[model samples]
Target chain A: MVVVSLNNVTKKIGSKTIIDNLSFDVHAGEVFGFLGPNGAGKTTTIRMLVGLMKITSGDIFIDGHSVKANFEEAISKVGAIVENPEMYKFMSGYDNLKHYARMVKGVTLERIDEVAELVGLQNRMKEKVKTYSLGMRQRLGIAQALLHRPKVLILDEPTNGLDPAGIREIRDYLKRLAREEDMAVIVSSHLLSEMEMMCDRIGIIQNGRMIDVQLVNDMVNGGNVSYVISAKPIDQAFNVLQHAFEGINVKMTKQHLHVEGESVDVPKLVKRLVENQCDIYEVKQVNQSLEEKFLEITSEKGGIA
Target chain B: MGLLANEWIKIFKRKSSYIMIGILAIIVLVAAIGMTFINNQGTETGDNGNWKTALEAENKDLKEELKSTPGPYKKEVERVIAENEYRITHEMPRVTSYNVWTFMNGMMGLVDIVALFTIIIAAGIVASEFSWGTIKLLLIRPINRAKILLSKYITVLLYALFMLAILFVLSFILGAAFFGFEQNQPHLAYLDGQIVERAQIPFLLSQYALSSVGLLIFTTMAFMISAAFRNSSLAIGLSIFLLLVGSIVTSIIAGFFDWAKYLLFANTNLLPYFGTGTPMVEGMTLAFSLIVLLVYFIIFLVVAFWAFVKRDVAA
Candidate 1:
């Protein structure tokens, strides 16, 4: 089910368009990653979805309620952590959760405890937030956001300032929340590798515009992939493959000769190399990582992604 | 209502809130001690025996001294003689009398301290949420932005009322301890060119309540600044500076221009209309001052709520 939808949402501060006409949807039981460079309007879009900002034109609907008109009804379905997960420093972690729980109905003590244990903050729930580490504060923030059993959860830069283990812990927890609780999760970050491993689908945004949105697997493995060809008489093999695969890009690296084509072309290239008196030892298919794909797509626009 | 409770819990959890109450307690205690010491010194000097005879003697001495006093000092001396004669004729109690009403009256000056502390909290409540970045967490909830702002404002008013109650109850306790609970004392007021007497308890309570007008106005000013600017230090600094210097500046302006009566500070001190002092301007009546204060009060609240509701939590 589509849990969150943005339809032609645009935000303009004065004359400068902060977020151009953007549109996307997040479905249930999946992790949607919003990937963007700095100043790419990722936070701006998230803010509009959560009602922290006004949408200049268009609509955002959470759980089928329009955020612009039915803000209370729409926002009740969303739980978000924008930018840093800043909490009341003087309040204990438990008190902070309790404070927020009061605003939403049916948030009982058991629910609070359940979320605390889910976020792995059960032991330190009594400590003041000012005494908590950045990772601990992030966990507490997630705990508070989950108290209401929101249909959609949004977190901006959830892994920022977290250690490696902390990052892994949050990533693992978010995945569990989506699968086990059947909740749609939207996270925005600039960290590519984390998104590559954690997200099922990603929307890449640049300059207030969404450049592309695709499944993680489709993005990395669905294009004209390159194959690494290894053999003896490396210079001759490279020349034969270059001549055999006409109009296809082929290059020889330090360790192997690289040939770029669809997966089906691999066998034909190998047979041709064999027929050309070239010794072919190995033919390995190389899949591009999301980082490489991201660079390629963003570089096509002539700026940093 | 839940939002208000949330804000209440947040404010009470801070250490500064307790410190504000602590400071008020200490100030009241010190004032109590000082009043006791002065009363003891008056008793030791044998001036506490008969206030009527002492006033008559002082009146005669002041009149004799007025003959040789310069023109500049004559007015002050004559005012003193008039006050002493009025006290003697009206049978008003002596200042050295150990009574609860007198102590409660003395504690009225501490309302300024209450206003100062209340303004500090009021100024920081909204602005600090933005500065600390907690506003993002707050506004993402199910509540409306106006309700959130209203809750904070209500929390501030509740804190102010709490401090005022503490001051009143603590002063009552301290006063009853230092001086006997002497009821039925008439409060003397020099008004309309004569001395008039009214019931003490009601008069003192009204004075305390009336004195809070200044407190509420300054607090609203601080709150408006907090919402409009979202900078805690600037709000606290400017409101406090105005609170401290506003009266002096108003008087300076009032000395030169009759239009100064329309300014905020000119009308804050409602006690003057109750015969605590004369009006700053000649024709400024209690009704006029009350209207002026009400107008300013509405403006402050309108500005505060409007700014708070319209502001976008971009940061």
Candidate 2:
């Protein structure tokens, strides 16, 4: 089920368009990653969804309520952490959560304790927020956001200042939340590797426009895959394959000949190479990582990587 | 209602709030101790009967001095003679009594301290949320923006009333300890070209309530600044500067411009209309000042709520 939807959302501040006619949907029990370079309107879109900003033209619906008209109803289903997870420095972590819990209904003491343990902050809940580390504060922020059992959770740069272990911890918790709680999670970040590991699907945005939205595996290895051919007499094998697979792009790098095609064509190409007096040693498929794919897509759209 | 409670809890949790309360308590204690010392000195020196005789002597001296004094000094000497005669006929006690009326009357000075602390809290309440980036957390919740702002404003007024109550109870306790309890005392006021006497308790309570008119206006001004500007230091600095020098500046301008009567500072003090003193400008009546205050009060609230609701939380 689609828990969050943005329909032709556009935001203009004075004459400059910040987010232009953007549209997307996030389904329940899935992790959706929003990817963009600097100034790509990722934060702006998140702000509109959370009702911190007003949409200039279109509407954002969360759990069947419009953000522009039914703000309180729409926002009740969303729990977000925009930018850094800032909180009252003078208050204890537990007090901060309790303070926020009062603003929403049905958030009892047991719920607070449950979230605290979920975020691994049960031990440090009594300490003042000023004394907490950045990672600890981030955990506490997530705990506060989860108190009311929101249908959708949004986080912008959740791993911005965390070490590797902290990043892994957040990534693990987000995945668990989506699978166990059946919640839709929308996260925006510039860290491609982390997003690659954490997200099931990603939407690329640039210059207030959404470039594409696709599944993570499809985006990385869905289309034409490249295969490296290691055979004897490398130059001869490269020429034979190029001639046999006419109009198909092929290249030779050092000791191997690279061919681009579907997995089904691998046996046919091998048969042809064998018939051309070339001995096939090994054939390996080259799978592109999300980082390379992201660079390729963004650069194709005239954006600096 | 829940929002207001949230704000109230947030305020008391901060150390600075407690510091402000501590400073107020220390100031009141020191003043009470000083008054006690002065009262003890007066009693130790055996000056119990000197007040009446001294007033008589001063009355004779002032009457003689009025004959040869210059035009400017004559008005001052005649006023002194009138005050001395009133004290003699009314049998008013000296300052050394430290009675309930005296203690309550002395509390007028502490009102300014209350205003100062209240202004500090009011100025920082909204601005600090933005400065600390906690405003995003607040706005993302299920509450409306107007309710959030209203809760914060109400919290400030509640805090001010709490401080005022503390001052009243503390002064009453100290007054009873120093001068024992008196059944009936008259509070004297100069009103309508005559000296009118009123019940001490009601008169003192009115004085305290009237003084708070200025306190409320200044607190509203501070809150307006806080909501309009996201910078806490700027809000606190500008509002405090105005609170300290606003009246003096308005008085100086009133000399050159009669239109100054419409300024906020010129109308905030309602005590003059209650018989404690005279209005700052001639023809400035109680109803007129109240109307002026009501207008400014509405404007401040309108501007504050409008700005807070319309502003996009971009940061």
Candidate 3:
């Protein structure tokens, strides 16, 4: 089920368009990653989703309520940590939770403790937030966002300032929250590898626009297989493949000529290469990782990042 | 109500709030004890036995000085003479001894200190959230921005009242402990060109309330600045600077301009209408000052809420 959606949302400041015609949907029980480089409107989109910034046009709906028309009702179903999850540092972690607990309805002291334990912050909740490490602060922020049992949880740069182990811990917690609680989680980050591990699907944003959205598995393991041909006298093989695969990506890297095409055509191409008196010593296929694909997509769209 | 409680708890949780209260208590104690020491040393001079004769002699010297006194000091001399003549005719004895009531009366100057600290709170209430980067978390709550801003404003007013209450109750207790009580006394004053008598406590409280007009306006201005600027230092610095120098500047301008009567500081203090003093400008009445204050008050609140609710929470 679609739990949250942005419908053609655009944000403008004076003559500058910060976000231009962005649209996406986040489903229940799934982690949707918002992947983008810095200054690519990742923060702006999150801010608009959480109602911290107004959308210049279009609207967002959360759980069947329009964020623009019925903000309180729409936002009530969403728990969000915009930007750094900047909480009151002077207050104790428990007091901070209590402070946010007072703002929403039906959040009990029991709920507070449960969330703290879930975030593994139960032991440190009595200490002042200023005394918390960055990872501890991130956990406290997540604990706060989960207090209301929101149907959708939004986190902007949730892994920021975390150590590798801390990042893995948050990643596991987010996945469990999506799986066990059946919550829709939208996480925005520029950490490509982190998103690949944590998210089932990701929508890549660039230059205030959506470049592409795809499932992580499909993006990495699907579509054209890239064959790297290491042949003797490679110049002849390069010329033949270059002329044969007219519209395909055929490029030479070091000793191998990389030709991206359908797997069924590989044997035919090899025979043709053999006909040209080219010796194919080895033919290996490379499954592009999400990071490589991300680079290709972003660079193909524009060299903005 | 929950928001108010949050804001209140936030204020009181900090050590600075307690420090403010502590310093205020210390000031009252030292002032009271010092005044007691001075009162004991001069017992013979205020013996009420020859008080009328002493006042008559002083009045003769004052009348002689009034003729040669400059224009600015002339009104003060005239007021003293009028007060002394009224005291003799009415047979009201001079305040020859300190009483708890009088001690409390003198301690009213500490109200300004309350205003100063209250201004700090008002300035930081909204702006500090931005500086700390907590506004993002705050504004994302299911509550509307207007309600949140209004709650904050109400919290500021409530804090100011809380501080004032502490000052009043603490000063009252300290005053009683320092100076033993006499009977509830009446305050002597010059009213409408004649010396008149007023109830002591009611009059003193009214004076305190009236003096707080400056406090209330400046606090509101500081809140507006905080909402608009998102910087506590700017809010605190600009508002406190104006609070200190605004009246002096207005009086200086009042010497040369009639329009000075419309200025905020010119009318913030409503005390001039009650006793021996005159209005800063001719033809300005209590109603005029009230209307000016109300206009400025509404303007400040409207700006504060407008800026608070409409602006995006980027921080």
Query: Which portions of model 2 show Cα errors greater than 4 Å?
Result: A262-264, A274-282, B42-96, B179-184
In the order shown, the candidates' DockQ scores are 0.80, 0.83, 0.79
Q: Write the per-residue lDDT of candidate 1 for residues A166-268, one digit (tens) a residue.
A: 9999999999989998999999998789998889999999999888999998997898887788986888888887777556888888769887865447777
lDDT tens per residue, model 2, A62-92: 9999999999999999888999999999999
Candidate 2 chain B: minimum summed lDDT over ten consecutive residues — where? B71-80
Task: Give one digit per residue, the lDDT tens place, for model 1 in B1-315.
Answer: 788889888888988889999999998889888888888777665455587887888888888898999653454566567778877776664665677888888788999899989999999999999999999989888888888888898898898899999999999999999877887667777665566678887787799999998999999999999999999999999999998899899989988898999999999988766667656766888899989998988898899888887767787
Residue B6, candidate 3: Cα error in Å is 0.4
Query: Is model 3 an incorrect, acceptable, medium or high docking prediction?
Result: medium
Mind giving the per-residue lDDT tens digits that candidate 3 earns over A1-305? 99999999999999899999999999999999999999999999998998888999999999999989999999999888887868888899999999999999899999999999999999999999999999999999999899999999999999998999999999999999999999999999998899999999999999999999999989878877787889978888889888875456788877999888655378878998999999989998788788888898999998857
lDDT of each: 0.87, 0.87, 0.88
Model 1 alpha-carbon miss at residue B44, Å:
4.1
After the best TM-score superposition of candidate 3, give how far the Cα of residue A14 lies from its true spot, in angstroms.
Answer: 0.7
